[model samples]
Target chain A: MSAESYENEYGNAKNALELKNITKRFGDLVAVSNISLEIKEGEIFSFLGPSGCGKTTLLRCIAGLEDADEGQVLIGGEVVNQIPPYKRNCSIVFQQHALFPHMSVFDNIAFGLVEHKVPKAEIKMRVNDLVDMVNLNGMESRWPHQLSGGQQQRVALARSLVLRPAILLLDEPLAALDRKLRKEMQTELKRIQKEVGTTFMNVTHDQKEALSLSDRIAVIKDGKIIQLGTPEEIYESPRTTFVADFMGASNIFSGKADVNGDNNILFRGDIGLEILLPNNDKLEAKEIKGISIHPEVIGIALEESEIKALDSWHTVFKGRITEAFYQGDFSELTVKLNESDIELAIHLGRGIAHDKEIVSGQDVMVHWKWEHNNILYS
Target chain B: METIKNATSPQSDLVVKNKKKFNVEVPLYMGPISFLLVGFVFAPLLIILFFSFLKTGLYGEIVYEFTMGNIKEILTGGSGIVFLNSFYLAVQTTILCLLLGYPLAYYIARYGGKWKVLLISMIVVPSWVAYLIRLYAFKTITGTNGIINNFLMDWGLISEPLTMLYTPGVVMVGLVYTWLPFMVLPLHAAMEGMEPSLLEAATDLGAHPVRRFFRITLPLSRGGAIAGSILVFIPTMGDWLVPALLGGSKVMMVGNLVAQKFTIAGNIPSGSSLAIMLAATLILILYLAIKWGGKEAMEKLV
Candidate 1:
């Protein structure tokens, strides 16, 4: 949601966090450009992008770990641009997890409470509760070096959460873990966020992590927000080529659109071929960009009779398979249209992909519903 | 599991094959160095040990009697005071070096950035000058007729020259000046290797700057601190030049006492015994430091 709608829906007092036109520059490079966003109370929001794309920079600016060259950051609708990180009421889990190597697990969790001079009994109770929450109950007395990477990450998460800050910022908290551990931590993170009901702002370059864990994701590139929406919305209707490419592999065609009727437009691909799109009012000019169809959305069939069985709203193509790559559970077919230079990627699962005849140079028909194609405006 | 096994089994087989190759190469690697170490190092230490157990003759001859008298005297006689003074001076110099050098190392590591190499070089450049020359330079600076006294006289800050030379304090200043780089270099290395994100996390966790330094930076750099203390403390314990030149006759350390027995008094057995005692003290200090600092301390030196 936009900041205005967020403020209206949750009221100013409950908006949780907001950044108004925040920008940060380092010497000759603009690390984060003019970007404004809002996260609602108890929401799990994510900034997703490749490295050097300013997603982490933006998170740091919000956490007051970095001073933005322009604009204000708000926590609970209170402007915190002048406050230091300690006073901003936000805690961060660093990308390295940053567990204190010298301190025991219990002390690392109790560090913030000790700084605040909380009562000894209360500190013990709180740290124990957090240790249980992060599933590190019995290992409290062990040093950070003795723990594994996953356990260290749990300590880092508990350390930040024990303070009960207004928001928790995570900078690729699982990036250092193996793929299997990363998936496990993703679920653990989601569960903890739900239990605590704290606003979470996670930054990651892994699209799968953001898709599976985030309540809403902001797709960023070149220090700007390319698109911000729910994961399903972004997956279904990416507004830019970068978003489509970043989100996943897709058949991308940049072309001009000519109005066909009341609700239809013909997109002539730059490389070749033409496809139909349900007209969107946002596009007023003939110049069209980021016309993409997800590979999974396109269906493959061996016979022309099967192509005829598809609905009228579906766009079909007669193509020859240029290459067939066999993945363990599926096969990916790179298809070049019979009379056009345009290539479309089709993914077929094990049942349909096991056919002996579906090799390179095999003739096939590809089709997808018009609604599955995203027509982006320049 | 399957992928890892497939990838590593061949590499492990190659490594096992290489071990056979290493067996043939061992003589080439170990020959000259082992021979040199045994000839020069172990032979001299054994000779010293032999001398230390012998009795000293009246005219400084090597007597044929075997006795532990020299070692007994060093432990029980008034020479204990000299060892005490030497240890006191070394500890004081180490504390001062730590106090002054930690901030310098921190500044260079955190704020020097592009100028870090230049700044570290400045600390190291003075070592290139001869050690005796540096001591003489200190003498000129602290003497009654030196530049400091001359400048004070010209400025009318004092009517006569202050007795800054040949004092225990001046000796300490010299020792600290000489060893400060030893302390700073290791600390700078530790601070430079510190992951900056750790400090950022500390700040985000509601720690003020001073608290963060005390709680995080200080503890994490303990390895460097311990290593630096060993580097400065051990050598200062046996250093003769600083005490001899800067301290004059007023401040006689264990090193000067040992040197006097060997050269001025010409008592080789007595001198070797004294040297052995000093070496034993240094070893004790090293053992204690390594025990306290753990493997992390030794790792930082590497």
Candidate 2:
């Protein structure tokens, strides 16, 4: 579902969790400011931000690990602000996995069931089902230390999921794994969430992990949500330069906006270039301070003659290539405009930049389409 | 490519090399400590074992003749009562220490925050003073004319100074007081070493605070508890001074019996036999505790 619909799902029957103006303070420091969110039922939502941005604090508030000084937390349409973490049916997978070092995997997963006074026969059935679901069949008797990082992660998941929590809050659970394993667990986590149909709220500082896994993301900054949107919407149409910069690598230019002829809006960038925005109702604002465009959306033409020969529908500018980096699969060209200190980052395919000998200090032409440009508020 | 392979493969290669030399290297590193252990500890035990098998002269001197007289007499004699009394006192001390020390340890470990070091030092500071001096402080407190009785008498709360000292109950108090730090330190360390996320996970999984403590905190910190219990129990059992001084000559433990047999009675053979038997029993119990409690108990002792 889109982020708009998820936002409208607040206080409705379809929401699994709702936080209303939650604010948690640690003495003088506001760890989480006045924040409200509604996560749709069974949706994989993420609180994405840099470190110390209160994303994790907000998740902990929902889990009742930290008491918010001022707000209400509702789970399944029930106001559970006063409920203890144990009474609330929300399980959290810790960043460290936090598997019990003393207990075997089977016992670790069976602990919750034992606590709930579930029958022995049913505990065995549920434990086995979870062990199999996490792909820990023969490793049941292994202690947490015996398992690999990924295996320990699976056990942590099994241990929490066995309780059948209404929502699973994961605190950077995959941050410990290697790149390949992290990617694998990302898909594995999504698959398991689908199979179990539990609402998942994940907190992470890794932008790629958030972008790849979340159905919708809340980009938080300074203890407040800067933007809330689907992954594509957040990456493509960030509400502010902060959201755009935090979401991914983007070239942001400070500018003033003005309506031109017809329905077009022109942003007079301080970088000595005017970028055009096609007819859009959102662009009706009188003035805007910043405009953002993804680095990957910009194209670089090496030859000046080739740049001039390019047809319309392209807003082009000449700049000197100050730095060129040949990444493993792609290449990045940082072009400094001749008129100002502002540099536009243009990402190119490995074939274009690497196959051809591109170097710094060379003059290059940068261009992008009208629609790929986004106006940033402040 | 070769450099990349070499860099990546070195760790496994080093591990294999270390594994190959492990047997020889372990003993080499441990040789000096083992030598001291064997010389000071095992050699003394062996001498005691030899003395236990000897005959006693009329004047309590050691005789060269080999005999089982002392060993046989111990089982049939009133030594069983001494053992029972010592064990009972030790059990009480251990239980009292655990009951009193656990919550204190938990609070210091979990909630002491910036004052954790200060709180731990407070528990440890009393023990740093001479042992006898600390015991005497308890002695003064529990005496008939001690602070509590004098205060109560002055307030007309009692007709006379109560008989608060030199009793089995007073001895228990002394033992628990003396051994409480041993319980607190280990329990605090264990509680501090515990992964806080485990408790959070337990709470997240729908276990209440009490259930979390019983199922997670208590079970996980059991190593420390058992370690603390053993530390208090074993020492309290063998202690003759507290029972002799505080229990007044009315109570006697195995240590007092052993002390009397060697010094007052001058029966070296009986005392040696009794000491050996106690040592053997303690070793057996320690072995069983280590086996049952897993690696943490053994590690804590070391």
Candidate 3:
């Protein structure tokens, strides 16, 4: 369909940006394939994926830096595929801040306004307000090189925000910062997005950053979004093995499922393990091909009586501790199952593992509630 | 106390031995370049400075009598016109080279891609041909019966041949052509050092192509432009060959006048005084250029 018709059909006033069947290719390799999504007016939405998964490429398509081969880009209820980047109402904060080294902080912020020929007094007011917003109040005359890395990023942010674009594209905005500063900027970025009331489309490979900062996230892999939902939904229930693995679920087992009784399904893992799963209304027992359990949710006990004392709803397995890592806040124990050679990662609170003497080569019983089991179809 | 003294004595001896070794190594490393600078460069300049204050004898020989007549003649006489003409030519050459070189350098740095090195080498390769021979070649191309005139006449574009050589314009062209590579190399370096994302950021901030060029690309590459101007300007001021071959007598520069005093007129004192003035002028210009270009760019060059 044409961009105009697409805009007219699906472009609601609430949606700040909408992309339809956007496909981009680099020579023969497809960098972004047939992707369609919408972002709300004031939402902090993120595209989460590993590096080279084409998340940045998708963001560039929205920014008009890269044109989509077979789709339309609509912003604020207008088709903008034919428009150049300078004419679009969206701005991007690059991964490397990409601040103009020659221009001062004030001039850098005022650059877009000057290009648009805004009034001189208004430009000053806007630039000063942004400098204050980004907390670089007294650094109006300082050059980009003189500022620290975080400070330079703030200037880059301020420079983009001064234009008041309809949507702000952040391409790994805090990826260049060190860990402590990245956390600080994540909070700062959320605050700034709220204050500006502009739609934020962020791209990042850091899952923690995405989970913490985004109101909604699209988990992308191999140039296609495999899952899109809120952080809680994606983390609690990933649909595919890739999403499960990428979201830090290490104990993934592929298996066949059979109906055991009226409401219970017995899953036979390929690794010679068996577990009972509660039958859900959405998925039939035979269609389920895999399961993932979060490492932190698994409980370990030293004795069979201690495991037997758990509720009947929990699935239990006997295993021996193969490796134990004592992290400062938590201890991680790798347990190899007795019935199978599968190794499961179990994270216990620091004092709990020390009190139990969970060392390597110790026999243990591992159990987790059935509700914590995340079923995967592919 | 006896053990402490024994320990200190051996350490002090070792420190003295290292210090002596360093003293020998310093001169050993610096010997050749230091000798060349003093013998070939500083000594000639000192001799020229001394000769500028000596008197010229009747037989066109230097008489070792202290006099400032040569300096006074250069300062107050018609040689001032030559200095002015040389300055004008240098300015014109620098401006022309800048106009031509900026785009070429930008193209090579921004879009030359895999051929960037080859393209830059192409610009530099022409300079490897001897300077005098290149000027002669240039003369043949623009001479009265040269390629351009013959082409124009063959095309029936003009009834008569155009005067293409021995003019001020021709001299300006030759100087710009000769010194253009110098301008390009520095500009290319500056532009190459610039992060390309700056241009993208500018575009994302609503700056169009033209505005982006002026606001981001131009100001960011100012260091290169300044360095290039200095490179082109200094050489063109002292260039005597281009004018002699292509400009004939119409376009006389300070370099040609100095050469005349030494070779044709055989006036050592007069030539030395003119040379001193030119050198002083170049030094002053270089100092001002560095001050204006800022220390950061000069540091990058070094």
Candidate 4:
């Protein structure tokens, strides 16, 4: 369908960027399978996946750097599939900054303006404003090589922002910075996006970065998006085992779900463990093959009596502590259940009673409420 | 503590032994090039300088009397015209080579892909054939009854054979053909060293293809252009073979004038002075080129 009709039919007039059945292939390998998504104006969207999962390829297709073999890319309600990258009006900040080593910081930021034939005075004013916005004031005359890695990245950001593109594509922009600097830049990037009001589409493999920085995320694997939702939805209600594992929910139990009396469902794990699933209207009891519980949701008690006082809705597992790790803010205990050989990862906050005294080989009971279980169908 | 000391002592001793061996190996590595520089390069230059200040006998023998007449003769005579011709031709050849070489070098560096080695080899392999043989081949192709004229005549394009030889233009063709590879090699090296992402960044910044080339590619490859210009200019200015074979005395360069002075007139003193002047002029030009091209050009050439 034509871009106008597609937008009219879908009522996506407010979407800053929309992809319809976008697919890219590299010879025999499909780098990006048929994927469709819409990003609203002034929203920070991310494509999160492991390396080589085609997140970068999807971003490139959106930026017009890579042509989609089959599909339409509509930006601001105009189809831009045939337009080249320069004319598409979507700027990109590359992973390595890709700053012009030959040009000074001011000239680098002014390059797009000069190409567009902006007046000289206005170009200088816009570049100066961007330099100040990205916190690079008084560095207009320095070469790219003279700046630190973080500083160069800021220059790159300012250079792209000066164009005021309809959509800004960031390809692993913070993947090169140190952890602390990455966190700092994450905050800076959010502030800049808010101030500019331009839609941001970032591609990264870091789950934490995507969770922290993105308003909505599409988790991709093997050239297809397995799930697309807000950060909280993707984290708390993963629909597939891959999404669950990718979101850091390390406790996945593959089992068979059987319906019980009065609409109750019980999951019997293959490893001889069992749990009562919470009531979910959308779940098919026969189709649920597994379930995932986040590591932080599982609680540990030194004695069975400690958790026995709790209500009946909590499922308890008697286990012995196989290993303990003392992190700064919390402690991690690996519990091997006595009923089965299954190991469960539990996190105990520093405020928990006797958390510091927890040691390896200590007997313990691991328990979690049924409401914390996220059912996985496949 | 004793064990740590014992462990460290052997390593220190080994390091000292390696240092001693390295001291001896340094001269061993530098010996051949140093010998060649002193024996072939410096010695001939020093002899030329010594001969320029001496007098010449009637039979082209070097007379052991110091004289300033040879230098004075050059300054007062029509050698200025010869110098101007050489300068003009050198500049033209450098410009032509740059115009033709930059695009070819950029293409090979950027898009040659797996065939890059083969393409660059095609450029370099022809230069490896004997220079005189290649010049003769070029002459045969451009001669009056050569392939181009014959082909055109067969096709009824021209009525008579054109005067395609012994002109300054053919001399230029010969000079450029002889030195084009020198221009391409350094240019290719400089262009190949550039990061491809810079061009992509320029494109993403709303610069079109032509604008991207001028703004990003051209400025980044300036080092290669300067180095290629120098590589073409210095040799073309002093070349005698092209003018001798192609110009046939119709267009005499400074090299031909110096050759006639030494060979035909038997004026060794005058020839040496003229040669010294040419060398001095080239040195000055090289200094200026390096100054204008800056450190980037120097680094690329080295």
**Deviation in angstroms for B70 in model 2?**
2.2
Q: Which stretches of candidate 1 lie over 4 Å from their true place?
A: A1-13, A280-282, A354-357, B1-77, B155-159, B295-302
lDDT of 2: 0.86
- Put down candidate 3 lDDT per residue, B120-155, tens digits, no spaces: 999999999999999989999999999999999999
Q: State each model's CA lDDT, in order.
A: 0.88, 0.86, 0.90, 0.88
**Per-model DockQ:** 0.61, 0.57, 0.67, 0.62
List model 4 lDDT by residue over A1-378, tens digit each: 233443354344388999999999999999999999888887788999999999999988988888999999999989999999988879999999999888889999998999889999999999989998999998999888889988999999999999999999999999999999999999999999889988899999999999889888899998999998778888988999999999999999999988766577888888877887666574567789888999899888776577878898887888999988988688887999996899998877867826437889988788888888888878
* Candidate 2 lDDT by residue in tens digits, A164-236: 9889999999999999999999999988987898889999999889888888899999899888888888888
Model 3 misplaced regions, further than 4 Å: A1-13, A259-263, A282-286, B1-21, B295-302
Candidate 3 lDDT over A1-378, as tens digits, reads 233443454356498999999999999889899999988788788999999889999999999988999999999989899999999999999999998876788888888889989999999999999988889989999888788989999998998899999999999999999999999999999899879988899999988999999878899988999998888777878888999999988889999988755777888889877888778754676679899998989988987788768888898888899999988899888999996789999888887887887789998899999988888889
Docking class of 2: medium
Instruction: Tell me how far the alpha carbon of residue A190 in candidate 2 is from the true structure, in angstroms, after superposition.
Output: 1.8
* Model 3 superposed RMSD (Cα): 4.6
lDDT of 4 at B89: 96
Candidate 2 residue B243 Cα shift, in angstroms, is 1.1
In order, what fnat does every candidate score? Answer: 0.81, 0.81, 0.88, 0.77
Top candidate (lDDT)? 3
Q: TM-scores for all candidates?
A: 0.89, 0.89, 0.91, 0.91
Q: TM-score for model 3?
A: 0.91
Per-residue lDDT over B56-112 for candidate 2, one digit per residue giving the tens place of the 0 to 100 score = 888888998999988899888899889888989888999999999999999998899
Residue pairs with backbone atoms closer than 3 Å in model 2 (clashes):
none
